[model samples]
Target chain A: MVESVEGHRLKLLEYEAKEYFRRHGIPTPQGRMVTTPREARDYTAELGKPVVIKVQLPVGGRGKAGGVRFADTPEEAAEAADALLGMRIKGLTVEKLYVEEKLSIVNEIYLGVTVDRRNKAYVVLASSEGGMDIEEVAAKTPERIVRHLVDPINGLRSYHANLVAKRLGYGGRKMLQFAAVIESLCELALEMDAELTEINPLAEVGDGFTAADARLNVDNNALFRHRELEERLLESYRGELTEREMEAKSQGLTYVELDGNIGIIGNGAGLTMATLDTVMLQGGRAANFLDLGGGATPERIGEAAKFVLGDERTRALFVNVLGGITRCDHAAEGIVAARRELGVEKPIVVRMMGTNEEEGRKILNEAGVETLGSMEEAAKLAVKLAEAS
Target chain B: MTRFIDKDTRVLVQGITGSQGAFHTRLMREYGTRVVAGTVPGRGGQTIEGLPVYDTVVEAKESHGVDASIIFVPAPYALDAALESVEEGIDPVVVITEGMPVRDSVELMARARLSGTTVVGPNTPGLIKAGECKMGIMPAQVFKKGEVGVISRSGTLFYEIAAHITRVGLGQSTCVGLGGDPVVGLDYVNVLRWFEEDPETEAVALIGEIGGDAEERAAAFIGDGGFTKPVAAYVAGRAAVPGKRMGHAGAIIQGSSGTAESKMNALRDAGVDVGELPGQVAESLKELL
Candidate 1:
């Protein structure tokens, strides 16, 4: 099982995220993202006093982490915007500030939609009281939070939506509107194909409706058909690239191009990562982590291995793989195929398992690729190879 | 005879103009997969590696009776390319394109539901019935026709399982790549079901990881007596750090319960002899049979 979530952290910009929520009919405070601090002053004035000034980063836990702040005055807002505008938090450069008009927020509550890991279904989480330090909210009043898992097929029914609102002490015809928003959010979460979405301080300002302080993380997996949503994700990348990394990226190869001797060829993003970790831990740094990816045939492996070996920093090569759907023997064949075509001038460490292990070993051994046992052993050998190089 | 795919299954290659598309399409032909047509819009009627190219999946399918397809389109074009195959009435689409955002996969998969078309992967290695048809980029030379059936989410783990099986003189009847995408069409349960009904397949080898209740659901199906066939499950990520997921979106196990340990426990509880080492799966299967 190759389990990985790549391209996380970089998220849709605030203007886009809010627009997405607003387009989905989910209530969010009216907001604008400004490029310059001058626009920040204008948006703050337009939003009036008591507005939230957030850095508009993609990562979660930002509010508690102080990536988000509220400004009581336009002057305070401009200063806040300046502080966050160019601030780099967790590799994401904060480029814009989301200055939104704050709502009355009588009863701040926490509501979220996430894929419940245990049940393998979409779940709806609601709390009567919202916001004030998420940690404190979860700790001080755990009982207020109501959770419901929705069957992806059946979806979140009206009663299920009402159940959350009723638990939150909402009722009457006004309760229906609350249900509508909750239902809308849940529907939108599923409709938009989100991984998780949180509306902390889903407020109860007026009797009938409330606004949502929306934080929606659409599942990147479902972005294909959602042209608008897909566009939002393009905004997620940092887009900052070093010259070499950009050159590698152009070829669709994720080449970190570290100052190391061993070039690792593997499949599965996680395995590739583990390979990197192993190599680093074993007193060796990797030139690059090349996941030929699953279904990497001998030819593709051959090509990837050649490319990895071609790097000037590469003095040795580490090929680690566990053939799940893609066979290791084929990868081994690719190694031999590539080496024969390109010639292996450097020592290669091979640790391969899964489908056709014997054949894989045989092919590599015949080609003179030294096969190791475990990933740790492979790393140790790689370290040894690097030192020798 | 194989159920889902066999030697005679007519095929089409999407993105046939690209190097990846052109190369893999040739391999499909060499492996005895009857690749009748290919698609690379504006490169219509041209031949790449000697296979006829078309403008779209619709035209290719209409002209060639293509039932199974292997797509080599880039990530950006992968969704529409896969969907075009689906729209053209193809079943069992094997999408080899990686980096397709998760959302595109979900949309394509949901659309597959509407048409009853099964998409193998947006990020996956396609399925193959050993000694017969090859769907994705499976290395045909390593595979041998035998009774042990295999299914996996990651293409590479299939190699380990096959290697172990081969060491014991066992070979695969059918190897299905259910794919790594979270929203892929076939899952553990689907392939397991096919293995259960396949006459030639004696024992089934399930290669799985954490995340997605695919493993647990397969366990439920097995526990409910849906699978009379013996199952041996080998799950990866034991060496993986607590929070670290492997590749493939569905492979991630968030929260406490989605760990590989939990998945292994669930499978064992359902009577699957889950293996820890790469070679142990074949050993467990030998005991069961």
Candidate 2:
């Protein structure tokens, strides 16, 4: 059975990251982190000429998102700052603005070290060509991207860094500088228990290296040994992240916010995922994917149901579980308890098979929650209910 | 007649002072496991639920001759405990802890292969030999001594198997959770091989979930060897297709290998009797018996 405990939050901000890279001798552009629009405008004016006023959101792609803008004139810079300071990038509202003198760069490169989702190993990627958008870089000039999969046991070696730099078509001194920065990046990644650290346009400026756009993600599970990372993740929750989400995360739950009418619940990861896909397949979007875990209590189930419905987007709920290590009877009782406590006016479609399923189904039917026999049927019912509601 | 565990299996609890370690250790001892010792640095020489504690696996091994270790340590420390157990030569290590970092699990699991040590779980529930011995987190009351052997990747689902087995008078030889992590020590093929060799394990109840190619591989092994003993398989997450990341760092299925469909198809191809109902395990056993 798939289980839910909360998963870790991805924590790292641009200002903190820039400061970190700067200290490590990786050149960052002349910039200021300002919370106030006045500070943002003033910094742009002081920087003079060509400047990039970017929203300091935790998520990626501020440039394409219009969260990032450039202005040649002072008034235009001020206007851009005002527009982006309050804007949202990928659902995260901008509370701070980073106004920086856009560096004069001859070359732009993408250097990143991220834990492979499959192997959980640190993988580094580098590519030459700065200033262009990363997506365009990925799509059109994909051959420019060079990759190195570092064995966690062996770690990132200097020779490996040199290979990536060389493959990016960088020659001699620039290649050496890039290799040196890669080593520094590796140190930062390993020391921080980082899941990812991407420096798009790690520029080869006049005699130095600077990361123009930085994206770093630290491994959440490894945060116990890293109290520093815990502080980094805490920034996103500065009243920005919802309490429900934070609670779900802290408890090791992998909660994704979706715009759907049905709240999907299941035990195993596969079933929970299927429920979401099936909801969409039947022309219904899912509000959330909540796995109450294999051993979730009736009380936990009720709380989860309440949490899912709390989004105000949910009109119906779907619970799919095939009990194995967890008894189906426990799941049934949990659903019953949830229904009684939450007074679920929302329609529920349950497909439970395995381990005391009959007893579990009996509890659900008696509780008046509609129970479906198949996952496909449950998804269809949930979609229909959501549409009707 | 459990294959992997019985009353004689000398058990050691890693992170014996933690909440889970404390909780399940008591239950395991109460269920009649020979929990000879525990490990929790400073908590050594102290007692929890009346079991002796040691500072390290070495101390536990020297003093108690702990052959198997039931890990209650947290995820970060799981690899350390697993490695230490192997270093101290603890056989059949049962790691009940979840959230193990994949890198460490890979190293430890790899080490397990090299050292000839058996590792049960990084996020598994553990193993139990019906009434004779309870090595994992399954409820004790559900078990009864008999021939059917239950094996799963999840701990909670196995409880359902146990209850059904209990109801049908076909007690479990032992239920093992290989854990749901992507890089685990044991897989379906490994466990099934053990079950095949065990005289006490007659009809086997193989419980699997929707990820990993462990089942496909297991089916191949079974097909090649032709396990004459009746094998009952129940693959959960029937409709599960979304990429569910591993909760247990060890549990992951890459490429096209470990999907639920592939595992199910593998079992079907192997000519193993698969059950749709939990109680159908008993029916399978009845036909074989």
Candidate with top lDDT is 1
lDDT at position A209, candidate 2: 81
Cα miss at A345, model 1 (Å)? 14
- lDDT (Cα, tens digit) per residue for candidate 1, span B1-289: 2368888888888888898787777777788888898898899989878778999887887787888888888887888888888887788788888767654665676678778887787667788888888887766666888889998877666755676676677888988877766556677777877788889899999888666677888889999999988889877654344333344555554445457778889899998898655457888887787
Tens-digit lDDT track of model 1 for A1-389: 11223223224555665676787777777778776777878778876668877777666556766778778888888888888788877667777777888777567777777655334456777776676534355566767667787755567789988888887788887577778888888877767666766677677776645554666666654566466665555445444334555565456554445556788877776456557656776778777756666566777787788788777788889999776556778889888877788765788899976568888999888877899756678888988978897
* CA RMSD (A), model 2: 6.3
Across all models, the iRMS values in order are 5.9, 6.7
- Give DockQ for candidates 1 onward, in order: 0.17, 0.15
